[model samples]
Target chain A: MNDVIICRCEGVRLSEIEQAIREGASAVPGVKKRTRAGMGPCQGRVCQRVVLQLLQQPPSEAGESPDALQRSRSPVRPTLLGDL
Target chain B: MNDACDVAVVGAGPAGLVAAIEAARAGLSVTVVDEFPWPGGRLLGQLYTDPRSHGRWDGRKISRQLAQEAGELGVRILGGATVWAVGRDLSLELSGVPVGTLRPQALLLATGAAERALPVPGWTKPGVVCVGAAQTFTNVHHVAIGRRVLVAGIDPLALSVAMEMHHAGVDVAGVVLPPVSTTSGALASPERAVARLADVADLAPNGLLRAAARLAAGKLSPLAVSALRFDLVRVGGVSIGFRTALVAVEGDGRVESATLRSVAPDGTLVGPERRIEVDAVCISAGLYPLTDLAEIAGCPMVEVEELGGLVPLHGPGLETPLERLFVAGNLTGIEGAKVAIAQGRQAGCSIARSLGRATLVSPEDAARAVSDARTSSPFRFQPRIAAGRAAMAELWQQAIARGDQSA
Candidate 1:
């Protein structure tokens, strides 16, 4: 099967996310760091929940734990560099 | 716009507008901020008939009424304004139309919900979109998504949006089930999807369609599944492809055609895949609470499957762990718009009480209104909402006991 795009903003593929999960990415932030799924302009608004569901898949040696959201920082909305 | 107000309601949807109205009525200066160009949030796209009242309930009209009421009560609604950053001290840094920071005494986050994504092979294509997004374009913006559309996934939202599109003179090619996957759950199976569809069968546009839906939902459900496996059923002139799953979409830059395959009663792919030419494909994966703002504000979030997803811990009065931060509407959980309005009223009253002010409606009364609205809600998005609410209350109690304090 073709690798479906998971992160629309960054064009992260599902295979990449699966590889990240195989490489001990148990949570959204971990996946974001490894695959940049939630590191796009929308900042995970579109792909965060999808990544969370993907992380909840079983048989993970990373051990089960509650999911955590990425810490939201300043300029939550897209702002121009001059605006800052 | 004023730099600050007594209360800042972020959304301007049914919940935020009602909350602002109640708070302003209590003599608290209220300001509302919304990212949308208009004040009405998701309500702008809603147009349905009340199964009880048998009258059309246009969401855009209701939104205008609420927005007007809030304005009469002296609420400042900053449409097209985005709260880019929220501070622990109830300070909101906004952009767009009103480009400045405003510090309010209390903050109410009614950020609402977003559609869940059901990604297929060609979902990223230009003509592919969510059912709600299509609804917004067709009903709100008066823009047609496509000349002919194939809607995948059989849910209340999908069915309703299909009907709305049909009424708007769009050729709704068919409604099919999504590909069988872990995330698809009940919708993956034909039998389960039929049962779930039967729950909201009354919402069908015409009586004949409603009768068919009820029959399919009732003792005839098994027979309906068999029929679906064999052939398609036309409901209200729109083809209902039962036992059929959309496996993949094939297109060049835009949606061109979708691959449909027959599924067994157990939701396993059975027959050969067939391609149907379609300009648009609307995936209805369902909805989840938009908790980005709550997460940003550092509110404690708990996962409640029945509520659709992770929601902030809030009391019956919609008060969060943060002293003056409250959440209402879909942000708390996925419920109908009426329940959101009731919750808004309750949150407004709670905010008034927390601020030690007198209000027209007591918090208890507002709470009762919420219960009333919940019971009377035509569409119960989640069947186990009561259970979700109970679990949330327990979580709130546990969080309090553990002293999980937040800023």
Candidate 2:
């Protein structure tokens, strides 16, 4: 899982997110700023929730509350200026 | 350009197209809007052969026919226009680029459903994608998602996608389904949960899969004997939908393998977890209604467990509480395209009647269309969805009553 890349856009791995959490990135945005997981073309549609889990729990525990997962973000579609 | 039209329908999918066509037939100036360049929502990406009609009712063909009919009716299509906001006055805010204020006398929000991904440990890997995304990349873009793939989940969508991938020469190792007992947060009450389970059971591929498996084992029934005598690959390939549950996916860099376990009907894990190596993993857990536009337009919505999520509350006529505002298709529920089309036609005719046109879709035609949709589609979840929707509508009324007392 450490070698496996979770954020395809940022090229970030699971370990990097965990390391950022270990280094005091306790929230989704904090991990995004610390580890570059959500700063991608997709704008974190894919990785932010996974980042949240890594931020909230230690790696070995491997547990995150699906029921307690945060709400889906707004403006569902990605907006590129040129496309607009 | 004129700022007002007889009707402006947002979304150009199956539901939207049908609504626009029906509205035009009623002698209305109809405008159909969508964010995509194409008209069909899920239809263009679907390629499943109808099991009942022996491959006659093609997905792509039906979608093409709807788009063509809409065009022939002089329906205007506005592609790539994203709706930013909609006022009570029916004034729409475009994405800061399209120069138009759509002030239609009637508005139909046919905005369709989107994929609902259930979380898995390795779901975020590079090669992991929703099954709909796989279908879109292959059918629409002429791009192969992966050379070898493992699809996870059960439903017509999963099997249809696996079949499509197999047709495209991708090695679809197998499709995996979770245990029937595995429920989503969408199911709230026990009664609704049990009803949805029955609906899933009625549509489950076990009978077909078992029949195919017996054919594989050389104990084929007379009807199955012919299917085996003709082609064993198709039967065997589709039969994989049974006998598996996805526990987790183990991967490195990209999707390297998916961990699966066999499960029984009683929700008991039957075998040791096994990992099958594959380049990609696609999950078709199911879809929830896409209701952002309906929400932004301020339509009252309630969580219908059977329909999969919170959906706009509407009367049987598909008219929202908002005046002259209507909704159809998956925006109301997750009942597939056939039902969506029927609801669209119903909404269109309802809108036309409100506008004082009498003969757009006759009463008999409207009844027939809805009846056909409820029973004709390959997938059958109408009973569960109908009950859930009715309960939601009742809940809405109770809330309104409470609000009135409070005010």
Candidate 3:
């Protein structure tokens, strides 16, 4: 489970997220900042829900489910800069 | 395609297609956009018997019917078009189509639900896929996941897809529970998993058991679980393993075998790990509403546990807090395709009414259709869907009272 890949895009492992949580990174963004789990191209679509569940685990630091992970920025899908 | 239209629906699923049909029939120029290369969304691979009608609900047939009707109504459906963002002014930024942006008088977001992932050890292996993807590949694309496949996760979708794969000539090794973790909660417990199976017992592929299950009628009597112990329930030759947990799927490059362990009824891992030789692993964690577009549209969302997670708040009429912005289908909450189609009709009429256009059917009638469909659907993804909808309606009233609907 420790070696299991949590974020496929960033290759973030389960151990990395556990480490992030242990270091006071309660919310998804905190974990993203520390371990870059959701910063990848798919933009956390695949992994944020798992991270949210991890936060609500026993010894939870999430408190109250941490406000729906930040609203996704523009270009939700991969788009070329040239298109702009 | 025209850069603008009377209505622009963000998904081409059952809900979006139905909404487009209604709006277009009302003489509104409608365009429906979908990210998939085809019009039908998740409605593609569904195949189940409606206990009420004793008839089959073939997803592929229904999707084609809806798409054909929409086309006849002059609704332009752009497949492979993704709406990347919705600007504050409600202008849609799109890709994979000739038109880069579309400005519409009204926008309906029927963005359907996405399957929840259950991450197991060695899940990233090549042959591991979500249960929904397995269903699609087998039923729609006519592709086999593997000759011998083991499924992890005992839910309605997983059970149904396992049966579907068996029908498609795949050796479905076994349908087992995912390992219990902080997230898996009741899913890992044999009793709880059996109770959930009892809910959809009518859909059992076995004729004798299906009749017995129908007699039980969605009741959770202890006798039901005891009579059909998970190990004893053979869903069309596919073994159901409630006490067994699929801990991992390991292979060199693709799936070659899976590791299973015994799970006690009290939800503890006991005994030694057992290895099962299988070529593929399909995991079904569950499903949640796909709400990215709703959030991007600036629609206020509320997390209703009954509705299967965060959904855009909307009234019974399917009108959201944003003016001229509407939502339907799984985007509002997780329900069957029938409920989604009904919600689409309601949203279409509501959109037409909002624009001061006469609709073929009144929004009130359409809303009744939504409720009727919800009540009659055999599959209950979320049992408390009605309660979830009522909560959402209450929240919508609160939002309206707070003057949030003017946007």
Candidate 4:
């Protein structure tokens, strides 16, 4: 049970993510939507890097090479829905 | 057929930026669209250029760096494109031009916020300005409104504007706050540490005297000052003053002035009516949730009296009542940039995991993100926002009725 709640706005706990993963969640996005981990006020600006690091880590290793993780996308910020 | 991405993140602000970057990192094809010619949305336009003088954050540099990073990630970035409407088909009309429809498996709406206006006498005067507009002018355009300016409202942004004005060598008359204390009455506890960090005393006197002295010192370039008596009124920690200028604030297709009797601390107007004169009136009145797109798309929205108005109701994963659609950023509630970004990342990760493309983050990581997001936001629920909303609605109704009578 990690004390660090990554997405404060939504009150998401990291342990919840681990639990969801243990329960069969596969990807970061899936885990996030289900857990409401990063859907808070800040919108993932601060948590993205942490999530990325987690995704890049090998499931078995402490600090595995980046090859195991998926590639991240761009625009790393919120845009207006009307402007999309 | 239109160009497609695995995710289409709109509004390039904190939320959109994180969403695009995370989705792309996860090997999802992503396209981030923005109405502005550049990224960073409001930050690019205001915070970056005129960053807080005392803060370590360099808004402009950060935005530029973020833009570069997004480019490096191979995310297609479109700027100077206005997204007018989102259709049921999940297609968007960019500007007036019709672009091909995209069926992104996931969509993130991070469209930030819009400034709320208060109706008052002479508000339409040329000197009156939206605190944000003044910020954009100073930060983005490198322009100043006047040698001396009066900034109203108690929002942090208003204080930031006053700071920017000081930096730009403009005099800040003072910040005006309504008599009501916190936006949320006692019931609402501070949601974030930042919300608890405000020192009202520090912001008040300094903001007032600094602006007044600057004006008295004639630090600004020569501008016309008509025969108007400047009255500086200090309320609580807030200070307000009037300047003599028949100027009107008109641009971007809206008139920005009105006449109303002054109001008391109890929200009652004082006197029959007294015209307050000001060269430039800046309203830091606050913000309203922009839920038009979400509403049109049939996302369930709840009017959280504490959270402003019309916030979409979503459980974990940014999921609303509508399946397969996710919302991130201020659309949920108006917190700040940092929170919006964290939410975007979580949304991206959640969507990716749901799609079976990436592994879910550990509970540790998720917890850290949540805590950090909470700490970064400073806004609390305020009843004044609701009151302001009601007052504005009444004003609008009265205006419409008057218009009808005239017709």
Give chain B TM-scores in order. 0.95, 0.81, 0.94, 0.70
Clashing pairs for model 1 are none
Docking level for model 2: incorrect
Model 3 C-alpha lDDT per residue in residues B1-407, reported as the tens digit of each score: 43888999999999999999999888899989999998889889887777788798888899999999999999999998888889776778888788888899999999888888777888888999999899889988999999999988876778778878888899999988886766566668766776666666755533433533443344334345444433435544777776788888889998999999878766678789989999999998888888888888888777777887778888878888888999999888888888998988988898888878899897678878888997787767886787888888777777779888885
Candidate 3 global CA lDDT score: 0.81
Fnat (0 to 1) per candidate? 0.36, 0.00, 0.42, 0.01
Cα lDDT tens digits, model 1, B204-316, are 54443465568677744855675553547777788877778999889889999999998887788886999998899999988899877787787877778788777888877
lDDT of 2 by residue, B244-288 (tens): 666677767788888877654333456687888888888865676
Better of 2 and 4 by TM-score: 2
lDDT of 1 at B304: 81
Cα RMSD to native, each candidate?
2.7, 7.9, 2.8, 19.7
In order of lDDT, best first, we have: 1, 3, 2, 4
Candidate 3 pairs with clashing backbones: none
What stretches of model 1 exceed 4 Å from their correct place?
A58-69, B182-186, B202-212, B219-231, B405-407
Judged by DockQ cut-offs, the docking class of candidate 1 is acceptable
Top model number, TM-score: 1
Model 4 agreement with the true structure over B1-407: per-residue lDDT tens digits: 37666777777887788777777777888788877777887666444221223454555666787778778888877787655556655555555224545567777777776655442323444666777788888888888876556665544566667777777777565654322211212211111111221322222223443343334334221131222234344433445432211112332333333222333322233455333333556765556556656655555445444444445555445655455566777676665666677777787776666556773564357536844765443323242333433443343354346552121
- Candidate 2 local accuracy as lDDT? 0.66
- As for candidate 2, its clashing pairs are none
lDDT of 3 at B169: 95
Task: Kindly indicate the candidate among 1 and 2 with the higher DockQ.
Answer: 1
- What local lDDT does model 4 show for residue B309? 47
- Whichever of 3 and 4 has more TM-score, that candidate is 3
Of the candidates shown, which would achieve the greatest DockQ relative to the real structure? 3
Q: Model-by-model lDDT, in order?
A: 0.82, 0.66, 0.81, 0.53
